[model samples]
Every structure is written in structure tokens, then in C-alpha cells.
Target: MSIKKEILKTIGDLLMEKLKNLPDGLPDLMWFDKQMGQFVPPETDDTAGGTPEAGISLPLPAVLMEYEPFAWQTTGGNTQKGSGNLKFTIYCEHLADSFPGSPVRDLALQHFDFVAAVHQVLQGLQIENVMSPLTRVLDEEDLAPDGVVFSVISYNTTIFDHSTSRTRNHVMVTNPGLEVKYKEESSRPVPAVEIPAFLT
Candidate 1:
């Protein structure tokens, strides 16, 4: 598979494995595909003062959002290996449980714990022999319309830069000759024979 596809596949699989056992009867693992514009979370109308349905079965609390390839550089002259920066976003809702008035410290702790869990899952992650150390970018909090908090993490991972090496392989074939070796018991001596230019 291509480097980008491989990287994403590895991350998606890893995250699913780590977060498979979330408590609170949260929704199953969900993915937000940027190209497809799918997997919008429930309670999205909350920002518009519309209360989410009380008993509606919404999608999972955790979602894998879009990833951006920010920067890339060649590790050496070879195109086989390089490094690049990939920013990934993960959104989760119900960060804290509210009382009659407001949320308690447990909410904050839950959010912190989720972030720590994701960090632990991504640290020193390897995909297809490429190593990545996931680092969080301390950007301003991005709350979705449904009140889901989004976290941006940067993955600076090694990539296999695929490039056609036609320029390196093309060479001028000028002279072609065949070298022959004979044993001592051979009856005939080795002779030089002219080879066709096209054979070069």
C-alpha cells in the first residue's frame, strides 16, 4: 500500500484496539471521512439551541477526524525514505458529567484521561517499519456544534517516498564484448567474435 494509506490504516486499527472497551455505553468506533463527509456526530444541533433528542441512539463518542500532511522532507538523497508531519484530529463528547448546575471535576479528569490514553497508544507507534512519535499541538480548543471537543495531534513519521528512478537507470550502452575462458583440456582456443551493436 501507499505510505499515506498505510499510515492511516495503522493508526485507525491501533486506536480501535485501544478504545474498544470504553465505559458508559458509548457508541462504537466511528470515523469521519473527509472525502466522503460522513459520520457526523449526534447532538450537532445543540449549538443552535436545539436540545438533542433524549433517547436517541447517537454514534460513538470518539471519532477519527481528518488528517493533514503539513510538511515533508527527504531523509537522504534516496526517495525511499523521508519524514513528514501529519496533523490528526480526534473528537469526543460527554467529556464531563454535569450535576443539577454544572459539571464536576470528574468531567475534567475524564477528558484528561482520554487524552492520556490516546497519547499512550500513539507514542512510539510504528507502521510498515516507519516510526512515529505522536505529539499534541496545543491549539485552541475546538468544540464541535454538538459540544464534542476535538484534539489535534501531530504525527511526524517516516514515509516511503515512492519515485520512479528512470533517470538513474538509463545509461548509454556504447561497447559490448564477450569474454570467454577455456579449460586446459579444451581442444579449441577461445576466439574473439564481433558482436552486433544492437546487442549493446
Candidate 2:
């Protein structure tokens, strides 16, 4: 296999292995979300003359690019802060069901603390030169409910020049989707309601 393919395979293997170690239900749910209507095959039809059949139909534009976390040290000069930065991605259909109300999306963020280990192992779990995975998601601008496609990205910080602060930002530049979630959201306070003093 090509070098890139091999590396990607290795990462995938690690992700699967790490996912296996997750608390049972969590991993299953992730898998379920990933598997939902995600593939589209080429169009074909019954043919006798070896000629074209009917009109062409567009396939669903959906995909899932998941990565297992990994880290490698200063292997050498050519490597230069190599592997200091890591990245993970997820591509899928961003259906109306896959947003805030979707448990899978919510749970994925929740499990990052545990699932993150999959990548940390690359650096022996030291976490000295690591950054949170960059996570970027893409979908339709107007965002239709049924067939909108989406993607997710998570990036690890890089330790360039041996300094920790100059890290690569996660969610590498891109226009985000209509929906977003923050880890600190749960900690945010709800707006207070005011009642007429006379009603009291």
C-alpha cells in the first residue's frame, strides 16, 4: 500500500482498538451514528445492449473520515516537531436529527476525555507537546433537514521550536455550520426571568 494509505490504516486500526476499550454503549452509539445511510454506490441498471440505461441520479454526498489519535516524538531533523500535531476527522450527513438533539454528537464530545487516549498513546501518554485535536465540521449553508452532508475535525497542538504555546489551533479555518456546541455550554447560566413586582 502507499505510505499515506498505510499510515491512515494504522491510525484507523488504533482508533478501532481504542474505541473497543470505551465504555460499551458509548462506542456502539458512535458506530451507529457513523453507519447510518453513509454509503452510495455507482448507478447501474439492467442492460442487454451494453448501452446506457436510464437517466443518471445523483448519489448522497456523505462520508465518514474517523481517525484514531497517535503521536510520535522528534524522530529526526527531517521530522522537525513531527507528529507534535495530530488530527482527527469525521464526515457524515448532518441531518436534522444529528444536531444538538442527537445523542451521538453530544456523546462524542463527552467521550473525548476518554477516547483521546487513543491518540496520546503515540507520545506514551505524556501529553507534554500535545494539543486538543482540531475539530472542523462542514455542511450545507442553508442546511436542509434530510440530506445535508457534514464533517468533523479534531486537531492536536504542535510544539514547534520546542515551545508549547505556539500550538496549531483546532478546527482549522473554515465556515462553521449553523449548529455548534461548546464544552463549557453546560456551565453557562440560563437567562433569568423577570416578573412584574405587582404580580408578587
Candidate 3:
């Protein structure tokens, strides 16, 4: 697989493994796309299934991952180095009823817990073919329709491209022999040096 795909899959697997056992239950993980039709919540079966859903479906929460275009520069012969940002968007339904007596009070601000857990799993993470450990570069939150709250978190890392590198074949010479001839003895070339024996 391509390096980009491998890196993304690795990240997703790590997050899935780490976040699967949270008290609130595991959240769905998906790759982000420009067309978000697939992310829309499915229609409810009520009213003969004609009514569209007001909000996205849950696992209560979900995460979408994507990466920014890489900025690249030639590092040396046939190799280029690049830096880019990887972003994760976490979506959750906002719960305003976290009053002291509410039974679901623990879930009122549960998105923060998910954010923290994501950071813990990803911060300083190192992956093969990547030059630097992942580091958080930005974090922001926004409100969506139907009480959905989403947080976008970004991390920066460096990677290298070696696709342009050429394969080279090398030959090794061992115990080479040398010949020498004196000016007066031009007719005869005598063995004057043997590499390993001469050095000894």
C-alpha cells in the first residue's frame, strides 16, 4: 500500500484499539471525504420511514480523519521531505442536562473525555517512514445542527519520499595486485605490491 494509506490505517487502528473500551462505549471511526452524504444519519423507521433524521446517528460519538496537503522539499539525491497536518474531527451530541441530579450527568461533557483520550493515544506517536513524532498543532470546537458538537484537532509530522531513488549495483575488489617498472628496466614489469600482503 501507499505510504499515506499505511500511515492513516495505522493511526486509525491505534485509535480504535485505544478508544474501544471507554465507559460510554466505542465511537465509530471513519475517513473524511468532501462529499459527506455517507456521514448523514440514516432515516428513522417511524412515519413509514419517509421522515429524514434530524441529526447524525450515534454510537453517541464518531471520529473522522483526514490529512492536509503536504509541503515538500528536496532533501538530497532522489529523496524529498514533506511536512503535513493530520486532522481528526470528533462528533458528539451536546447534552445540556448535566444538572447535579440528572441521571445522565456523567455524559453532559463527555466529548472532552474523548478528546483527551485521543490526544493521549496520538501525541508524540512515531510511525515508520515518518520523520517526526506527531505533535498537536491546533484544536477547535464548533456547534452543528441537532445538538451535535464537533471538535477538530490537528497534528503535524514529517515524512520522506524515496520513490525517485535509483537502484545501484556496486562491486568490491579484494587483495588487488600491483605492478611497477623502473626506468632502466622498462622491458620488464615486476610485481611490486600485493594489497593485503604489502600492508602486513
Instruction: Output the number of the lDDT-best candidate.
Output: 3
- Report how far off residue 111 is in candidate 1 (Å): 2.9
Native-to-model Cα distance after best TM-score fit, residue 102 in candidate 1, in Å: 4.2
Ranking by lDDT: 3, 1, 2
lDDT of 1 by residue, 26-123 (tens): 34455432322233334363333222222224353454534455455544443556655555555556556545555564664355456556667776
TM-scores for every candidate against the unseen true structure: 0.54, 0.29, 0.64
Clashes of each: 1, 13, 0
Give the CA lDDT, 0 to 100, for residue 117 in model 2. 41
Candidate closer to the true structure by TM-score (higher is better), 2 or 3: 3
Model 3 score (lDDT): 0.67
Model 1 local distance difference test score? 0.54
Inter-residue clash pairs, candidate 1: 96-107
Name the lDDT value of residue 32 in candidate 3: 31
Q: Put down candidate 2 lDDT per residue, 88-122, tens digits, no spaces.
A: 42322333343576767654344343334433443
Please provide, for model 3 over 1-200, each residue's C-alpha lDDT reduced to its tens digit, 9 standing for 90 to 100: 56677777777778777776666653544333222333444453343212123455544466677777889897666677789988877766675666799887777667778778778888999876655799999998774444666777889999766766443223455655756655674666777985675654
After best superposition, candidate 2 residue 54: deviation in angstroms?
24
Model 3 per-residue lDDT at 174: 68
